[model samples]
Target chain A: MSSSSQINKRRTKPAEVRIDELMSAAQTLFLEKGVEATTISEIIARAGVAKGTFYHYFESKQHIIEALKKQYIEFFIGVLDNAVRQCAADDWVSQFKVWIATNVQTYLETYPVHDIVFGVHHHERKNSEKNMMLEQLLQILVGGEQAGIWSLGQARLTALLIYCGVHGVADEAIANQLENTADFSEQIALQYLKMLGHGELNK
Target chain B: MSSSSQINKRRTKPAEVRIDELMSAAQTLFLEKGVEATTISEIIARAGVAKGTFYHYFESKQHIIEALKKQYIEFFIGVLDNAVRQCAADDWVSQFKVWIATNVQTYLETYPVHDIVFGVHHHERKNSEKNMMLEQLLQILVGGEQAGIWSLGQARLTALLIYCGVHGVADEAIANQLENTADFSEQIALQYLKMLGHGELNK
Candidate 1:
């Protein structure tokens, strides 16, 4: 109700905007200088935020890295989810193809950020991001199985195989600086469809 | 030779034996305390060697890690190679089965060392070890294709998928601590065989 309090409210940005600014600043610095060489001071300066504001949001460089990781996963899953939803609910084949194609394309576009966020956790044996991604792929696999589009002896195992297979090949594509990801993604989808006992679909 | 030279030669171990002793010591300490917590002094002490002797072989902790990594890959490839050789040369299917099963089993048994040595390079976008392992798997794939056991549209891509898929799943198995790896290994081999367009082999 005070005049000073009213002025502070007008100056302060919303919490979400503030958080996004900090993460964006950190990501840009991480990409440019490598995460190890980047500093909290550099991030806050880039965001044009007070030192207190940076500390209030993130405890350390490592904490912001975790937040960035969570943000990256949400964005990644959202992109894939939106792409998959474009297919009809019962059109599992199309749904899966879109998922594969979108996954490869999105990851290829975003892997520099992905590497920065996920670099330290690369050797972590247990990962929630991996699980979340697997869960997304699993829904498609289970749906196809229920529709009798394909049969699976082990749905989770098969999902793991396809999910991991797709991710692995994408890493190869990225390493090779592959340019024709559209064609490459299609080939991957078809090959995996064959693995799922749907080679007839390809023919 | 002089008397001191004769005594020094008699007192010293062979180069291979000394290198193995140093590497084994470093591996044990790395596994026990983690690579970061371990020190060169500890490695030399564990090997019952003097500081000079340690530096005579390795310049630093990182240097020894590099040596251990090389040693690990050679041992890993050697084990897989030996297992594949046990199968009939013309039996591409069995060669592949053994390769997958042995890859899973050996990686399961030795993953601690594998993680220790390869952990630092986890985020490296390009890797020689990956290529080397892929080359080993590619041989079976190419053999199978030549024999008409199965066909591939992209042999390297297929090989990358299978190699990374098997590795990723094995990592999952390790995280879950699944005990029946023999059955688990068989299942993986069958699934990948299916991926290679030979699912009928399972029946």
Candidate 2:
């Protein structure tokens, strides 16, 4: 083996690390200049990788965007998952409250990335990616139903209302420059809980 | 007076009629073939207007789209206004229900145009047009609160929740090909009414 080849091997990163670095760099650029203004060459330069390395993982700018989308979804869901874990296993009401609060807080803090990933596809008549978030939210609704905390005649629709309401209201809060996410979250949770026939929780 | 000048006077239409013709043609083409596929030439030909006539009214395809967006907002709000008129002034509950129902129904019927105009601009951080819809909804919410029909602590947030939830779920309904919009509308209204501390309305 040549001496230079050995040096290059020592500098090489794991495939997962390389992909993450590329995605991080792309995300920064997308947030800074937006997707339309960003390019593959800039992404490679920021990641300190060869042009071939980018093509090895991502076919084009859109592929990196797809990867960023998946990562955003996972990151969003993970925040809710961790928040829900803080409650007792059978305490569905607390779990639901935590889910709503964490959802608003996380979305408020990370909306630039959220906008970058979700901006272009609002016109799609149907979106399978939305269903992933819906399915996660459905688990909470179903759990509350089974626990006798709430009775849901149409759980999927109910989930859609709550999930969308949470997302939509956060956007409104951001638009209005809302100061206290915690206070706002509590208010939103009370209203949703009221819809679930748990108005007493507002007390 | 020349014979050609007199002949042209009879052939030329008033500005209002010409603008309407162009918009009608654009809406039809946008619905049938999507905004991306439709062309200005096709719009002019369909409207039976000369190229100069088209240019006189709109600067470009995007200009026409902006005009159509204004028309669509007016049409949408007009439907809700008419629906609310069916209820008496003091009957805010019924007014609210009609607002929600008509919003869902009209959106379901007219989503193609909605997607066409709104699809491209969803990423914008602040949209005054969306705020207009929210403002209309806030009147129902605040009116209900003032009339002792319901008590709302955060009326604007509630409006945001209702507006966003309604829009998001309608998108879901269209995606799922929901057949009976009436049943879905009633179910949605019940949940929202309950959130307004009107749980007895569900019975």
The best candidate by lDDT is 1
Chain B TM-score of candidate number 2: 0.90
A84-153 per-residue lDDT for model 1 (tens digits):
9989999999999999999999999999999888888766878999889989999999899888787677
TM-score of 2: 0.89
Best-fitting candidate, scored by DockQ: 1
Point out where model 1 deviates above 4 Å: A1-11, A200-203, B1-11, B200-203
Global CA lDDT computed for model 2: 0.86
Candidate 1 structure, TM-score to reference: 0.92
Clashing residue pairs found in predicted model 2: none
Report how far off residue A42 is in candidate 2 (Å): 1.6
Model 1, range B1-203, lDDT digits (tens) per residue? 57775677677776668889999999999999999999888999999988998888889998999999998899999999999999999999999989998999899999999988888876676888888999999999999988888788899889888888899899999999877788887888887788787645434
Q: Is the docking of candidate 1 incorrect, acceptable, medium or high quality?
A: medium
The TM-score values for the models, in the order shown, are 0.92, 0.89
Per-residue lDDT of A13 in model 2: 74
Report how far residue B64 has shifted in candidate 2, in Å. 1.1
Interface RMSD of 2: 1.5
